[model samples]
Target: MAAPPCDSSAHRAFDFWLGEWNVHTPDGKLAGTNRIVSEYNGCVLHERYDTGRGYSGESLNTYDAGRKVWHQTWVDTTGTLLLLEGGLRNGSMVLEGQTTGADAKLTRHRITWTPNSDGSVRQLWESSEGNGPWSVAFDGRYSRK
Candidate 1:
């Protein structure tokens, strides 16, 4: 059977991130590489991340029709799993969630993806504990491969 059409704007919100990319840190150091592919008639985005140091992970991203939001589940070889949920806002995809840190404190995590005019993408990850200010956890730029 043919797959259902995913032509809605919501489903295509993340299309700008679809491609093979080399990720770099803010200092210009190589961070990793990623390959993002659209699957299931564009209903799903599959991501493969390799840190080039034997560390790798995969994430499945999708738009939940019922919830009207985008969701992502990432699992890595290091046994780290992260689940984020959100949708596009002001041309950027912002996903927010809560996770427990090593100190057993709950941290609010927010990740934002912005597409640049040059076709590169910027990803910023921040975390905050309680009512504390958010601190940058990761900031990376993705250039097309």
Candidate 2:
């Protein structure tokens, strides 16, 4: 038989990440820290990011029971909004959608949660534009501090 539908609450896999987090590059460079919160009966995940580059963005994620997937929307103070729609697989969560703008570019966002030996969670974001190339956008490290 086919697998049962994925629970909407399954998206809560990232709930442990709800708090203050410091982002960094694989090379050990400090990127920024963000504060995350959960809203709407644990259905919506909200995040506010303040990168040292003077860029800030708000991310909102909601689980759709009908589609059995999670849809995430990110909007920055700079008028950049991205919509990502995907689901969980293996041990990672994947979201792929597009950017809504005059330029109209296709955007794919893949996120995965890897636990460190130190009991910390590492979340990575890889994005692709126009199905052209894939690049790492953000990597956040949270220690539940």
Q: Pairs clashing in candidate 1?
A: none
User: Highest TM-score among the candidates is held by which one?
Assistant: 1
* lDDT string, candidate 2, 1-145, tens digits: 8544433357566565577777766777767777889776566789888876888898988778777777878898789777878766665666776564576655666766666667667878787777778788877676554
Per-model TM against the reference: 0.92, 0.76
Return the clash pairs for model 2, or none: none
Count of backbone clashes for each model? 0, 0
Write down the lDDT of every candidate, Cα atoms only.
0.92, 0.72
Model 1 Cα lDDT, one tens digit per residue, 118-139: 9999999999997699999989
Q: After superposition, how far is residue 33 of candidate 1 from its true place, in Å?
A: 0.3
On a 0 to 100 scale, what is the lDDT of residue 106 in model 2?
Answer: 59
Cα miss at 115, model 1 (Å)? 0.4
